[model samples]
Target: MVVDGTYAKMWISKGILYFVYKEIYEINRIMAKQIVSQRLQLQNENSYPIFCDLRAVKNAQKQARDYLAIEGAYMTTALALLVEDEHSMVITQLYIKTSNPTYPTRVFTNKEKALLFLQDYKE
Candidate 1:
């Protein structure tokens, strides 16, 4: 993942390595590149889940929603999220609402609780 920011970090946990870059505004060129590259690198593994908290970021624009939706779709990732504010929930719902055919995402205020339910989730 390529990022022009104050900090770029990647955290690996439970087969999902989350790459977080400092937020940028007005353009999604850099962020989109990172997500696509990361997903490709994660191919042939277990689920590549992504958890994003946008409580303090700039997301007044509609592209933010599309960005998350695209990430979920392309990565086929099951998403788990915690929303501490309305702004974050707005973006979260956008992703949840999309509901891609290949990607199934779940939202939860409680991660541990959600995980327990997911353990028994069968389609």
Candidate 2:
């Protein structure tokens, strides 16, 4: 389900994503995000930011590209830094902190903090 608040995003169903790089994995993840984004398109949209969670299924990291590649989401870049710590650094965090945002896009660790930041953020 897409949790609505300050942080609008789709929650990846537990085990919905498969760790295998099989073709189905990508398709499934994409389909799931597509459904959620459509549901939570934008409403009373806040400048708070956008956050995506990749809590499990290591292969899902690249799904961010597919999810954000959408039209409105282009301005939406995500930092999956907090969602997972897969031996790699969170490049998206640096992107958000150092760069300027043309759109309402920002990603955080867990949904709670992200929601809080987006909900309470003052423009």
Best by lDDT: 1
Clashing pairs in 2: 50-106
List TM-score per model, in order.
0.54, 0.39
Judging by TM-score against the true structure, name the best candidate: 1
Cα error, residue 67 of model 2, in Å, equals 5.6
lDDT of each: 0.49, 0.39
Residue 41 in model 1: lDDT? 59
Which window of 10 residues has the lowest lDDT sum in candidate 1? Answer: 1-10
Off by more than 4 A, model 1: 1-8, 19-30, 42-46, 60-64, 98-101, 109-123
Candidate 2 residue-wise lDDT, 1-123, digit = tens = 433332224432321211111122333455546544543444223222344454543343345544544443442323222344523226555544555444444554555655554443233
